[model samples]
Target: MEIYQLVFETAIEINPGAVAVGAALGIVVGVPLGAAIAKLVQKRAERGVKGTARVGRLRAKRAWDA
Candidate 1:
């Protein structure tokens, strides 16, 4: 990905020592950021599923009552 490549490229421009440090830091920061984004997406998906299920149940209940 361009994003992954950019990290290394930027580090290379900084200095030799910084390249390793930057790569390591990128990995460390990227993992948790990625995980958090995944979690938020999962939560949104769950809420959508639950909300749709609830609406279906409500409609079913109204039909039954009628």
Candidate 2:
């Protein structure tokens, strides 16, 4: 049998209750994990954009004064 079929059969044969509980826990954990990762990426991008804007303003001021 293929690996997936074997795995499925084993999972069903084992404590079905445990499998259900584990799947539920995975869903709960996964949602927050995904959200946290997305938030972190967004914050990093915002910081990068702010830094670039500051540098650009400084450069423009220097060029204008010279």
Candidate 3:
């Protein structure tokens, strides 16, 4: 959540302009970025779900290092 919030917050800081163009640009850039993040996280979750399902496995390597 913090990461996703940071992405939008950075975009707004860069593109804080008039309503039409700023909104258009934000949508153009933000949607794909958000979707890509979502997909990557989803993939990671899926790959690690089995191995990390146990509470004792909380610090185990996930898809990022598995």
lDDT of 2 by residue, 1-66 (tens): 699778867897987888788789999999999999999879978777657678789999999999
Instruction: Single out the weakest 10-residue window by summed lDDT for candidate 2.
Output: 46-55
> What CA RMSD would you report for each candidate?
13.2, 14.9, 8.0
Q: In candidate 1, which residue pairs clash?
A: none
How many residue pairs clash (N, CA or C atoms closer than 3 angstroms) in each of the candidate models, in the order given? 0, 0, 0
TM-score of 2: 0.52
Candidate topping lDDT: 2
Winner of 2 and 3 under TM-score: 2
lDDT of 1 at 12: 82
Ranking by lDDT: 2, 1, 3
Q: Is candidate 1 or candidate 3 better by TM-score?
A: 1
Query: Residue by residue across 1-66, what tens digits does model 3's lDDT show?
Result: 999779768867776665457678889999999999999879978887665457445545464376
| C-alpha lDDT (0 to 100) for residue 8 of candidate 3 | 68
- Write candidate 1's Cα lDDT for 1-66 as tens digits: 999789768768778687888678989999999999999879988777657678779999999999
